[model samples]
Target: MCYYLKLKYFTLHGPLPGMPPQFLLGNLAQSGLLFDKASLPEAHIAFKQRYGDIYQFWISSTRLIVVNNLNDIQYIFTHRNIYDQGDIYVQKFSIVIPHGLISSKGAKYKRHAGLTLPLFRRGKIVSNFDLIVDCVDKLLIRWRAKSPQHLHLDIVQQSQNLLLAIFGLIGFDYDMETLDNDNDTNKNELTKALQYFLSNFNIMLFSPKILSTIYFKLSSQYRQSQKTIEQYFDRMIKQELDNGEELIAQRKRTSLIASLVGSLQQDEEMEINKSEEDRKGLSRNELLDEMRLFLLAGFETTSTALAWFIHLMSKHPQVQQNIKTELSNNNSQGLLSLDQLDSLVYLDCVIKEVFRFCPPINGTVRTLTVDDRLPETGAQLFRGDQILIPFHSLARDTRYWSIDPELFYPERFLGADKDHHPYALIPFGGGHRQCTGQDLARFELKVIAARLMQYVTFGDGGNQVNSGGHLSKLTIIPKHVGVTIDFDK
Candidate 1:
């Protein structure tokens, strides 16, 4: 079948499918061996240029269309009915949790969202400022310690620490204190789960396409490991519910899980019950899946972003200096208000620009619910065909942003014509299923960036820092990035 003919027949508008696809592995192997390397970005860009934006692939009869146009992306994201996290890993993962915001579809998703959103209301986030501030202070302390030996910091790990602390504010009455943990209760389960996620993430990023289905089965070890983490999460949630006293009453102690389960189990007086079985809350399956989602979105995405920020800083000392100087005068003692953060014009510009160049989640996939025609080319997209949007490419595309898209230019995100396209800068994705953790991720990054700007004089870790590539799993990430921080004062 001719490529254009296929699109015409299917009533879809996309790049003509090129290359003869492999039977079992499909073009996924041509992009890179799925077993050891899933370099989709490299392939997406190359073929996107060769194939002209939207390219088609037959991955074992599952039609794949890769889209780079902003218009196509907007259409798919806006029409949520067809798109679900239908990835094999995600589908199996959902079988466990059944319906959390990440797993549920359609009506189930709506119900799950209703049950969870209240806990993250704007008011609640505002009230929790002190918790976030406290966590940043801890991160600063760790950065300060790096100066003595002039050590190389694994920012990936630091970013993880930062997020766990955020969850601590939302999870336990206590801080995770991951940086200084001596005990295993708060530290062990979370750490092990994340570590497992990190290791598994490598397998996904570099693994061959066949490993995805035939050779791949959820490991028994992964199942057992999931249980250990959930048992801990359930215990923590039970503590909060059983207390019956809101953390605000005696202390600030409320976990997201507790918040979730609390909303599920209602009461006469409306106080959430903290029962033992509820403490074991999630079914073994539920715990594993949620843990996977948490680690992927929670830590991996945010950490890679933070790592990129620091790496860019090391490369551009002057830019970092400008940020530090501005922050030094403006931090106004400690902890930035959201309003104050908004006002840090240059800092905000830098972060946005950094993401423009290096997005955390490189791309996302959405399936078409109904036949749709493209506004630009008047091409049609048929239902059930998967549209893979290479978000990073779109963000930095020369046609949209003009020449030299790879350069780190923070000003591009500022004033007048800044990232003009509504759907162009999608570090957190778009529409209903867009990442909810975006707020928390930004909050953590801003605080960490401000603190690092305050205390560290960044020096280039040189080529070793940038060459390791990303450990792509649920979230795309920079692999083995290391940096040197010279503490100020």
Candidate 2:
């Protein structure tokens, strides 16, 4: 223990502050801070109260500096070149998405990111508006079938199926009949695989190599589920390769898979003259990795956000009524267009507030590249040390917003908190590494929220069912999101 303390002192700044009487396990028990599988944000909040904005903790030999201050986070993220997604993320996510953009670095990252950027641009996203509406209409039809009963619905399950259907049609040009049929074998298998992976990911990533190997061998279900999910993606990639070009030319901007294929082909042509090391473009396996990533990320995060939004709306019925009024006032004809979706300003505020209040992802981690001192505290950071920018903490910090940050207030965006610090509310994150699909995510939320408000009234399922607490999966999910849906006549 003395030796460990001395080593920590020599490597990091002396006795780096935070909760004292360090746990015997050296914060490995608190690894949830990184993955956020528990109430890690609350723990971080407590740490901030005790130790100010910047503090250090250890997860085995690894040292993490948690930065809860807005200014510090802004500086760190803005200076993107100095930091890269940490090895912890790469090691864990690579198990599921080996060569995907999220896990790749350097020239490969640049190539993939460059190719993918065009597909997610604002205009390109807007062009898929019809596809989104079509998918949402199907969902509404499903809800209508359950209408007049005022059914107590599982918002999480409903949202997941809805987004999965949308992602299937728009993302891959594949029809995942998740909405029409509840027992989609492939969908259930994939969801199970994702859940198992997320639940066990941190342990596998952070454990010693030998122990991790043993654990992997012992967890046969996890291994099989991973293989099953990968095989499914492989099949999808093969289908795309076979038909993507013709489909792309016909549907143009509507199919994300088509765009990805087009980009891959363009890269292949560009790489023809280059040496092996100089070559850039996705191989079949690489494409499979990216497709799986898109499928999971496209649906999982958005559905979780929608679930949280529904739960919040149920809790605050007045807010729900206001959104319905806004939708009705904006589109009197009862049919929504992309232009009209954009015009529903209060709904936009509600969406923004939902993102701010219950961000699906708690935060992301970056690894330091060189020795540096924090601008605010002059705290020293050595190369390879991990920096954690807690997004939840910054958004909820009392010092940054004019209004109380804890309250579930959508009007804050429209009023006093309108001009809060730019970095204070980074729900999708900030700088170069921020989520590229944010526009698509936001657009999806608006369309769904608008459509739902137009057709159904979500009533509170009472304290037993709607009581707010989060389940920290790969994203922060609303644990108890039961709502009573009253479909309009």
Candidate 3:
């Protein structure tokens, strides 16, 4: 099928099935369906029902293809050499995190991934197990201080505070006293900067480039916010370099920043041995960009996942009892070891279910490098055409899953969907460009869930407050995450 545009005299391939036109604004007015702060996932589902798995729409003059099939998504992600990160993401995120792995492409992305991958390896992450456990324990202590009369808690806010402390301790060697000393002005400033950047990120990403530029020029608050965030990153990067030099002198590499700095130095030495043309080390500004990306991505996704886990547990008391039973059976006690945490088999299933049910990211985008035909439909794709792999749609598609995808059943992993298609449940994406910190994220989730289950029970805070809807932004966040916490006697 093809769509002919009267104004441009151009031919476009594939189905064009959506709401009626708005003259010059072809789907731009209805852009709220896909890009709105709320109801993004629902809009995708509605579009899929009208059009097939693969459909085309216009965002102004640029054409966008939404690919919802598992096979197509797998093919695109696996062929990382053929396609690169979409221009939208590079253009939107580069201003804040220029050379970070998420925005960088080609050799730069490979270099950043190589330098940062080791820090998230199983052994390295498990080495920091005690630190993560201590953070969880501190959170639990705060909960213990609360009145035991089924106190209502905002899991979203609480989880954010807990993960910020963990990220501060592990990502950087600095202490963020947001969890303990609320009066700490430095920590408050840092937290506010991060929150401000994240809350407004989608606005910057979706607005037209010209409009955003003009707004930034006129809005002093936006400019000042960006300056504050950059200043904080600069100070943190300088501290990391100073500490990294001392650690290198002692021949000990502990933090992620130290490892990155050491790798950069090695690259410099190698470059000196070779010609100047072969230089590959990251510059100081590049290092700062990556550090900012790590801090933001690390804390935001994990904390959101934890909030969902807690909210789900509150509704499903049986799942909580099952996790507690698994903990008891595994003989967990006194700061559980990594092995003990891993042994909580039922809890693992529950975590997987939570990820499938409420993914942190809704989808990822890719820009075509050359003219190509989609393998499944044989549709023509031009160079520079943008493709979206809707993660939420694939995970919940009934065609790909054996059990009913709508139900919140953790047992599906143990039985019906044990050997499901790999791409059908990719919460962290796939192929070379997948999240580098997935191992660390999973370990943190398991440890926090286990620790929380050991000390307390979560109950639903009634339908009015606990009704689950998503607030779409940089991430798909739960609209309401209020829960009642009951301490274990």
Candidate 4:
């Protein structure tokens, strides 16, 4: 049966090179992925080295074509209609946020994107700059209270707190109070529920894809977390409805949740006989999922990126000093305007390098819609086949960089490696399905980092704790981020 299945699925792609799979388990057991023995990103790097660019990876009977060539990646991302959303992407995210934009495609995706994308545009995000700074100040205050004697801190948790507070306010006009309330018991019930959901979801990353549905069904904690999350969304929706029309209209400018609620109400008022294709707004369940997606994606990716930035800064004091120099050179006084934030050129390079060095997402997957051939690699692909485009691999590949890709230097962006291929350093995946909240994420990160630079300098706690390694969750975050925070007088 295994041989027959292999002949049927794998052979049709024309004997693509990859590690031989174990019977029944496929490559899961041999790849050390099933038991958490290897990091998936590193494993992809190893496979690319061994198989040369394009290779096949199997999770049980499921097959994935992992591609490392820039041209192939560019072609796949650019031609979104042909590749759509990958099976793996839709499969994994659908389990968590089935109705959200990340898991959707075609007409449903058009509806969700139409309703929500405008709220995350650059103009709307820039308008909320002060709100972001205010949230960061609350975090700074919390950290200041732990000064001198207790300055050593795990930035993973600290970054999480800061981002949770920021997203809670800007995303929904709700305050998580994660910074003010340190004790888990004292956290808002919604915050606690979100924490619980994410913790369990992280565990799901290690488990096999086939077991995800069964695991969610059997896990009582998972069910309870879902219930609590739903309850929170219910209240938010009711509050939005109670505000009537005027408040919702005003909130559409600043609050993503308010905008979504307005869209939902619009859907309700749509003509009943209209075709599904003509419908634009989301249903209530979808509204809940979109809210959950905003909460989950908003905080999770930005927090992880901030943790990476902090970890990188602690290791490279020179880079930190450079950023400080840039800030001082600009005579940045008090909170910076959006134009002022954009003026910090060196700081911009450092942030870009942080993303390249360690993308929050390891890779993005895209599934083929019709039979096609890769433009550069000449690899034949079948309809419904999924491909993995590893961001870490692309960033680290020496072939694509004029400078040593292994080095953690930010200056490469300004000098010899300047004008690198556009697709070479995509922390956020590209093309039509690119991350909607990316503008907001980048703006928030710049504001927070800039604020931190003004008031404090991060020092390496020591080799034992500060030496960089990553922990893979929904996003990749530092495994150990103990660092000393010295307050500037």
Candidate 5:
């Protein structure tokens, strides 16, 4: 009788409210997540509507608190000590890139972030404006060749290639050759490996953890892709290490590889006598993992954002025209200078609106470290409890917006919503654990959007083809992004 009472008291359901779990399946059967009745973002909105902001969602047997209100989001995001990286976020990435910053925690994360984050700061990224413009021009050149016919282009693949090219040159000093006229995606080992990993990674995300682990070890295809990726990274790392001393001597050290190699060498010398816990530099394996993570991070999010930007432009030609008007007024002929890029204030508003409307990331997760109650909702949270901060829900909340939250009005940012709550429109998230490469991501989006405005006008590909829906992957990308690309020049 005592044992039964204890079991009843410590039930996994706790006090939060959600749909009753169906044996081991939890709410998966009713969640509409399995059958594709609605996209993940749409499901989140539906959940918010059904169960108010601070409610519970069960994934398998695990219970997660879904917090959509801005006050609760502010509290959770601000309190990093109380709410660290959630297990879901850490577990999935740890399986793939164990030593990467995304999987790391506490001191190790600090060391990794410390060495790498500075490389992506505004000062360094702004200096690479011309390089970014050159990459955008490569995409323009390719599209120009295809402009003879009124092609209904799916810009996702092209955007990915363009981003890959930019990240290769700007981040690693290597040309991905993605934008090359003769380049083939199927034959490219690195490209193929990345694609294979992401596809499997998505599968693993939905599978039971033990099953995912077993699949990883047993699958020959996964092993081959892993080997190919490791070999590519190994060659790159070795080349960087070999050139490190020469580059340092020449006082011309640039690129992420050079900086990372330099830091590694410095750490090796400085921390040779230090204990493992006290050591500051990343190990060789850590470097390898970081390389993989950086490649994905550098290209994936920005490319996804670009895809959304194009989709939005196709739907709203007036907004595109406004951007073009701003560009022309600034006389941004040829490649724009840093001053010229900044001078297009209306263009900046459009980019901000794009981020607000369809944030590339649907949500960010945080796990509570101690027992607490939400100040606004008065919901009790346990130490091990996880919370989903839905970016889409927060942005679309009617209480926070002066204009209708459903409307995609860039002018809102210039008017009543200009002084909008900072936490409400956090596409990159907020607080200490916010995305480190946010500055670079924003700059890349702005520059690319500005360049596209100068060169092309995207027209609606019609409702049958152009109707926008979310496809949730590593990022939330457009499900159907067919746009008619008309070159302004």
Candidate 6:
């Protein structure tokens, strides 16, 4: 039982309806109660049972206002002037993701988001559907021919392959594709450094970047990989820059880099005279930041999502059957189309439910911009305090969900009572900070689910996988568990 607020002699009226937090630690040690899977299904069940809907919980001395009510969320996320992406323990990301949209906070975030917003508009993403579909279709064909040996294809590996393909086809006009997840996914040396950067990122986070400075500076392996990846990125960027005028003139957009390069070039020579630097919006380093961001961000979350999808769907064959039934003949061709996603509403519902069940991201933190009090719970917080919105907990909150919110029933999503609060079902988050790649991520999940359901009947292999998956803050991932999969036809 977590304690509620303890008032000081100098403060306002009666005891505030909040939790009694640890003296200095706040609730960081005991705060796990907020995240407990057993405690999560019921929204504010743990908090309300002990601390009410809006209670103060501390994380390693950082204050977080844990909220379950709908309106409070709207007020906090909408009134960005008061609350923004919180002061984070970003030591983990500084050397890894560094300065991209995912780890970026404050007005700096808004600027980057505003500038890069053009690339992901509906017109562009929709236009590249064929490229995405082609890759999925090819993977499906490979899966269909598999021999009947309980095939627990490590989804971790498979997802990277798929993401790498996306990078090649749609993101960058590079033709490099890898069957294995461990090898080069790109034709350029840039591939090496990007992979090297992420694999070692956890170490830097758990330990410290200062420790790796020696290794990064002295070692041949780390240095070489960095050089290769950086060089390839430059080569690609330079090629695009050199061909900027002609590429746009020819109206060819083979990859994201090409598209970006074309977009940068002005219609006439007058544009160049203004400033060469203005014409090239993202410097070489800035381009790498975006590239690494998408590669890791896109690949990891979607892959883990697919892994979890397989984990749950395989356990529940009936659910998989229903998805296949919905997919029926609609997915016979190479890729599932946007129209197909609409028809397969149940499948879509299942994905939504899955996100609700096991959201791939834990709560993301934001720094307090101003002091404000919650109208519903009446908890007041000050400026500079950090707030973590636990999406994983929110999705499973029984207070907001239907009958035993922990139960994974896709049918629960079908009813007229499906008007959930924006913050209520936030696997992709809400408000301005919401995920930009949501459409592509959902489409990819559907295609992978449809592909696996079409050909493979999967079962859990009895080794060790994170029983519930590990939370990396960036995305939650299932550990290496041997799963047995049998072929359909």
Candidate with best lDDT: 4
In the range 339-425, model 2's lDDT, one tens digit per residue, is 888788998889989988888887878888888777876777888878888778887899999999899999998999998899888
The sequence of per-residue lDDT tens digits that candidate 1 reaches over residues 1-489 is: 656544543332344655556544456667663643655555667777787876775444345677777876777787676565445324434433443557656554565455554544555555556676677777777666545446465676677677766665554443456867534565656566646645554444333344633323467666666567677666765666676655424443235555554543333233224432223223334333443455455556667788788778877888887887776577633445666655678888888877777788867666666676766656667776566677777876877774367778786666443747878788888877777677766766776677667666767766855454655455556665666777766
The stretch of ten residues in a row with the least summed lDDT in candidate 1 is 268-277
Task: Give the top-scoring candidate (TM-score).
Answer: 4
Which of the two, 3 or 5, has more TM-score?
A: 5
As for TM-score, the candidate ahead, 4 or 6, is 4
Ranking by TM-score: 4, 5, 3, 2, 1, 6
Alpha-carbon RMSD, each predicted model: 6.1, 3.7, 3.9, 2.4, 3.1, 6.3
Q: Given candidate 1, what's the lDDT at residue 466? A: 49
Model 3 regions more than 4 Å off: 1-38, 57-62, 150-153, 181-187, 243-246, 249-252, 263-277
Residue range 331-386, candidate 5, lDDT tens digits: 88566889999898998899899899999987888888899989898898889888
In order of appearance, the predictions have TM-scores of 0.81, 0.88, 0.89, 0.94, 0.93, 0.78
lDDT of 6 by residue, 1-489 (tens): 122233331112234455555543344335353343332223334555686565665443344566666677777778777777655545445564565666676554654565565666666666666666677666656555565554554666666666666655566676555543344444344555555666665444333246555555676777787677767767776777777577655544324566555434334355435553344344445557776665654566676687778777756778977887777757633345668756777888899888877777665555677787867666677787666677866776677775577788888778732776567788776667667677667766776676566666776654454244444533665555455667665
Model 5: lDDT of residue 122: 75
- Compute the lDDT of residue 118 as modeled in candidate 6: 60
The segments of candidate 6 whose C-alpha lies over 4 angstroms from its true place after superposition are 1-63, 89-92, 97-99, 102-108, 137-146, 151-153, 180-192, 203-224, 249-254, 262-280, 329-338, 462-473
Error of 6 at 452 (Å): 3.2
Model 1 off-target regions past 4 Å?
1-15, 33-38, 57-62, 81-92, 95-98, 147-153, 172-177, 181-187, 201-218, 245-255, 266-296, 331-339, 415-419, 467-469
Per-residue CA lDDT of model 3 for 334-366, tens digit only, reads 458778987888889999999999988877778
Off by over 4 Å in 5: 1-12, 23-25, 182-187, 244-246, 249-253, 265-276
Score each candidate by Cα lDDT.
0.62, 0.75, 0.75, 0.82, 0.80, 0.61
